[model samples]
Target: MNPWEVASPCTQRCVTRPTGNEQAYARTRRVPAASVLRRYASLTAALGSALAAGTRIADPSVLQRHARCVLGALGIGLDATGPLRVPGTAAGTLIVANHVSWLDVIAVLAVEPVPLIAKQEVSGWPVVGPLTRRTGNRFINRDAPRELPRFVGELAAHLRDGGSVMVFPQATTWCTAPGGPFRRAMFEAALRAAAPVRPAAIDYARDGTRSTAAAYVGGDSLAASLLRVAGTDGLAVRVRPCRTLWPHGHDRRSLAAAAHAAVSDAVSAPVLAPRTGVFRTARPPEATVPPQLRAHA
Candidate 1:
């Protein structure tokens, strides 16, 4: 069975900165405890509102809209550059983006309530877990490489059915780069499903400069990341949508390379410095989602 041929449903689902323009972001050197506290309170309130609205309505756009409002209250601003260029009437579109912070997900959701393809672990995260479930995300277990083919096939089928799916092909987040390297696997899904691929570049800026405060890299705890983000002023998110790519006889490897280049060209290049801030945790070789979490054909 071709991994790209599996037609199964998914079991799980799963910012920037400032300046004056430059002076808009607070210039305070130190993060005050009170400010962080206030931000957390606002975030909590926004989250509660979203959760309540989610239970009452099944529309993803509504959930995303509510979440977007809360994120703005949390002090994150959004800016979109370039034309989105996606066909409004096209059967499901595939969006591929570079992952920077956990806020990247929220940024995209705020812009559009698109469902996502995320790791199984994300399905268990604190506030994010329930939100993703409510939004109907597809979660994959990274430990089981053997299942990738079947999973890709199912993903391809979903796309073929006019269902939109978003994926972070890098599979992990990086604080200082456009992306690590584009994995070719998901590109295969586009080929199989004949879906148009849209590469989006997402960046975080503070006080008119790129900021790493939102990066959930290395030993940084979630609380620490949140506090840092809340404390930063003029934190803005920039998203650039590149030209769309069609299969057009392109193979998966070529497709992946093209998408990677398109996204990289639109964003800042990765810094060459030691990325000690972003640690790569090793997973158990056999760790994978339990049977109950996966979708059956």
Candidate 2:
């Protein structure tokens, strides 16, 4: 494993007092200690237990918590809440959401207690990819369609074994509400795997009409986006309830359409406020490695 380097580009020293913008930053500001410590602890233990644990790594919730803490320490925070709650369990499931920023993964994983499905390229990036793989994440090579089947098959077994997967249906990070058409690939994977699809809406807001939400979008890099928000006084994230969709035994195309509609409808809600303080449900399964998730059928 490579040494973990600082990935987020936040530069703001945690401000004690707020001047409008900083208030929003404070609202989301929460330290990234325990999550980070917990993960390292798990890694040390994993080294001793890797052989017994097989090729897959050990518990990664700590890494996710560490990530959230790191982002929080850097003045980045996410508040995800909804009247309609999505139950999280170790039970096999699939999650789909709109892509807002690369931070979307961090914010979601910080609060969401499950592994993720990211793009193939992320697995080869600098520090981020290493961290991603350490957490037992998988990806689809948009360029290599042939390998997708094997990946989908692996995801299927994961669902069958009661694991959960999260996917960004938008495929690319864009800032507009009702963004581009939801890609059909992962939707099909979930259908074939018989995993439920959960749609989450992610948004950014700043003081007044200053528009902090738009900073993370466009062709900007994730590091650049984080630095921009941290340097600013007030930037906030409001995540909507992830809309969970049952396959309904539908075809891939039909399921894709339904999934897209579900996500699109959820994003239609008025802008939401940020959620805080380790939002969690009780007894979320702490899946470390493949376990029974690597099924063949």
Candidate 3:
């Protein structure tokens, strides 16, 4: 916290500066806090070991509650609604959601019971990693090709234990409602784990104003983004339904298609509209939804 405090550029008083602009953010750092006493109070009630033993995590929802209040006080409305459940939860599930802001995971966690599948680097982050780990987040090396198999194995073990896992298949944040193709890694991992994949689309809405960019993600700096959150309006957790996925074995195209359909099912088509603000599509142009994923109810 000390390093964050520096003399304001034009004043003698110490203040922290926001580093890593949009461009610089693309080059580094991905990944907050609170009324400490309040958080502890809430965590004790929401995430007691007994609750975790029951295969449930209570931080995201609890945090969401507090965040909603704070955002509301600042005139930032967090308007969220339906498509709140996921399948495979009874036998260990894997949730894949559209990525917009870091809060995306929190929203899913609030609704679904699962441990987060985060980037391995997050485990070493100063304050972020500590909080994440304490909340049961698992990490993988986004840059490591060789470690893929090991990662898969660990996920399989976790699922076999009837534990749910949540992953960000996009690999990067996008404005909400992009409806982009899900990544192959996430698809493949779900397959290897033999767990059902729930494609959950998440977004934020306020005063009927929905913006995919509402959460600070993509080429945004951690400090800048956090400040933006600390300074802004309320955001809702618009949860789409969970489109259930079968075990993997399909090629990348098939897997992507399956994911798209699940996500699309959760949210209506043409998810991007002026009324919808902006959409971000960061994956390959050819990625699509597979028919098998949408064959049944």
Best by TM-score: 1
Runs of candidate 1 exceeding 4 Å displacement: 1-31, 55-58, 81-85, 88-90, 268-297
lDDT of 3: 0.51
lDDT (10s digit) by residue, model 3, range 1-297: 221111212210101222323321111111123543343444344333323333222355554443343333323333233323333243366667777676666455444545688878788876456556766888877566677778777887787556777887766665445335666665565565555666666765543445433445434576655454443333344656554565646664687677777676655532332232111233212212344322233
Q: Decide which is better by lDDT, 1 or 3.
A: 1
Candidate 2: global Cα-lDDT? 0.55
Q: After superposition, how far is residue 31 of candidate 2 from its true place, in Å?
A: 19
Quick one: ranking by lDDT, best first? 1, 2, 3
Ranking by TM-score: 1, 2, 3
What is candidate 2's CA lDDT for residue 166? 79
Q: Residue 190 of model 2: what lDDT? A: 66
At residue 60, give the lDDT of candidate 3.
53
Residues 175-257, candidate 1: write the lDDT tens digits: 64475767789888888877778888887666555665566665556776777788876676766677777776699999888
lDDT for each residue of candidate 2 in 182-211, tens digit (9 for 90 to 100): 766666666665556666666665542213
TM-score, every prediction: 0.77, 0.67, 0.62
Q: Model 3: how far is 92 from its true place, Å?
A: 1.2
- How far out, in Å, is residue 296 in model 1? 30
